[model samples]
Target: MHFLIIGGGFVGTALACELLKQAPAGSSITLANSGGPLGKGLAYGTQSPLHLLNVPAARMSWTDEQPDDFVNWLAGQGNTCDGAAFVPRQRYGDYLAVRLREHIAARPDVHWQQLQNRIDSLTPEAGRWIAQCAHGPALTADRVLLALGNFAPACPHPSLQALPADRYVGDPWQPDALSGLPADAPVALIGTGLTMLDLLISLQAMGHHGPVLAISRRGLLPKPHRENELPPPQWQAPAGWLAAGSLRSQLREVRQAIGRAQANGQDWRDVWVALRPRTTALWHRLDERARAQFLRHLLPFWDVHRHRAAPQALAVLRAAQAQGRVQAAAGRLLGARVDADGLVALQWRARGGQDTQEFKAARVFNCTGPSTRLAEGRRGLFGHLLHDGRLRPCPLGLGLEVGAGYALADAEGREQPGLFYVGPMLRSQHWEATAVPELRAHAKAAARAALGC
Candidate 1:
């Protein structure tokens, strides 16, 4: 069997490793990426020492059976960290690269190759999937995995489009996006999430002392993980809460659980940890309207609590805010234009008010996170897939529609055989799919299913 894994990031690399362990002796695997080292992707590709993994070392292993693989590897490299330690993301990237190389060296019977190019299009032909790359010969495989990872940030607000290209940045992951900016020039960031935090840290490292502003609908920043490990909380769902089958009811139950935990002097985060295992199932139980309500009303609150920052990283961000180096506000961008003095003038309406205000900044960054709505201006290979009816958008528009065992589903709800996906986008089907623990399991399962096991 020959398997082609596109976008050789964390998901693709994990899937390849799983295939190596389970496929037949003569199986072949090809991992393709446009640039950067394998397995780094956007999240792990950062060179900044300030960029740290949100999760602790103990739970980052790619394989469940080897729970300590990452931490043990750290020790082998003369860096000792306990399972609870939050390490730099670059170290995790190095760990992934080393593990891939070692796996290839040990499995001499399996053919493994890496292609440093982008896949431009995919075509199904002759019972196999053919992937055409931008600068290489096409690859044909018995199966294909679309580990495309996160999408690039969408275009910024229409008003911001009038600004000079150099004055605005749409993608934060670009290596030089933050380079060459004036140290004293004011800057505005368009999102108040993890991406904004990353840019803030990078700017500080670059010695940028300019005033910074971050704007979002809610102005909510992610909470920090607890510094000390508490015993895992033991909690149970209220009787018949799941059976009630209402999103609002489920949320109320969760709030009640948190209240109970607080009353008992236990951290509310422990309740969230205890509830992790049931999140996907609970999401599936909701009807379409209830799902929509959750997204409209509760997603912001859930996101801040669920995807938290490392304690160290959060401390730095809070310190910056306390010192007035950074400012965050709840608002919506109205528009932007370059002024006579060469500064970009931004207009926005603060949340809960109708009046508009203006702010001048030398640079503006659109860090509003990845665009998940497939029907809205999707370009490149994914757009092609959707256009050709090979992939369907999820009902909630969070990502592509996927069926049982990670199979790609078409517009009419038919599963596309031999085509699979493993990424955070799987959140369309599994609400808790983005994190490492959930993603690693999906990779293993998808590989096993693809190999007919």
Candidate 2:
């Protein structure tokens, strides 16, 4: 048997390791990624020490079955690291590569290949799947897994749309995106998520000292990790809150759930963890209207609580704010234009009131998170799949809608043969799929299911 894993991000890499471990000798595994590495997807590819893991090292294990694998690996050398502390993401990427190399070395009979190519399309032939890559010959495998991770969110502003090459930083992951800017240039970051923190640290490291403006819908920044003993959440979701309920009821239930979790000595992260396995089921349970309502009303609150930052990063952010180097505001983009001083002038309205404001900066970085519109993703493979009726977009217009077991369903609600999807792409189906703990679980289950056990 042969398995072809696509994407090569955390989920895909994790799936490859698990599949290789369980497969019998002579089974073949190939990882196809546009990015030329075994690990270090866009999120972890940076070498910045300032970019730290949001979750503590102790809780960020790649596998639930082996809790200490990561920490133990970090412990092997005379080099010392605080095991429980969040480490640099570059180190994590190196660790993933080391593990992959070790697994390949141990399993001599397992054929492993890393294809540095973007799979353009997938077609079924003779009970197998054929993957066409950008600059390589087609790969034939018995099973194909779409691990293609998040695509950067599309630029939302029209002025941004018209800016020439050096005017805006559209993609945050590209290393050279901001390389040419002056050291002290003012930068406007589009969102206030972890990526914003990353850019902030990078800019500071590069000696850029100009003011940083971060704009978002809520203008609300990510809350810092509570120090000392973490307090419990203050909301408890009501019964039947996520099922067969109106949007208002669902919102009330979520607030209640947060309260309950806090009272029970758990943080809101606990409620997020609790909702993981049931996310797909709940999403499927919701009709189109309810799903749309959830997206419209609850997504912002869910995201801020869900994708949090490390305490260390939070401290830095607080310091920046105190020093008046960083300013955050909540609003939607109204318009933008290049000003006489060679800066991008942006107009936006604050969240609650009708008051509109303007800001100008030497550079504007689009950090609004990954693009979720399925059709516009333009990765070719996904677009082709959707265009050919092999996959359907969720009602909320997230990624390709998937069913239980991470199965890709067709327009007619039929499962695609020998094809599966896991990770953030399943967000429309599983609201909690993007994070580490949930992705790890999904990878394990998906790998097992791929084996036909």
Q: Compare the candidates by lDDT and give the number of the best one.
A: 1
RMSD (CA, Å), candidate 1 to true, equals 1.5
Predicted structure 2, TM vs. truth: 0.91
Which portions of model 1 show Cα errors greater than 4 Å?
A: 234-243
Q: Give a tens-digit lDDT track for model 2, residues 1-453.
A: 989999877887789888878888999999988885777887678878888877666566778988777777777744355545777887777777787787778888999888888888888899999888898589999988888887776887867978766778889878787878998787789998877888888887788878888998887677655443133444444555576565677567667887877788767766665564567777767777887887887777767776677788888778889999998888888887889998888888888869888888777889888876776646488788887789887656687776666678988888887899987877776666777778888899999889876
Per-residue alpha-carbon lDDT of candidate 1 for residues 1-453, written as tens digits (9 for 90 to 100): 899999877898898888887778998999988869998888889898789898999989978989999999999999998888899999999998888888888788999999998888889998898898889689999999988877878766877766777899888788778777988889999998888888888888888988888999898998888885435665555656446546777787889889998898878888788778888988888778888998998898898899888888877778889999888999988889999999999888999999999889999998888867788766777887888898888778788778888899988879999999889888888888788999999999998889999
Q: Where does candidate 2 stray beyond 4 Å?
A: 78-83, 228-247, 254-284, 377-379
The alpha-carbon deviation from the true structure for residue 130 of candidate 1, after best TM-score superposition, in angstroms, is 1.7
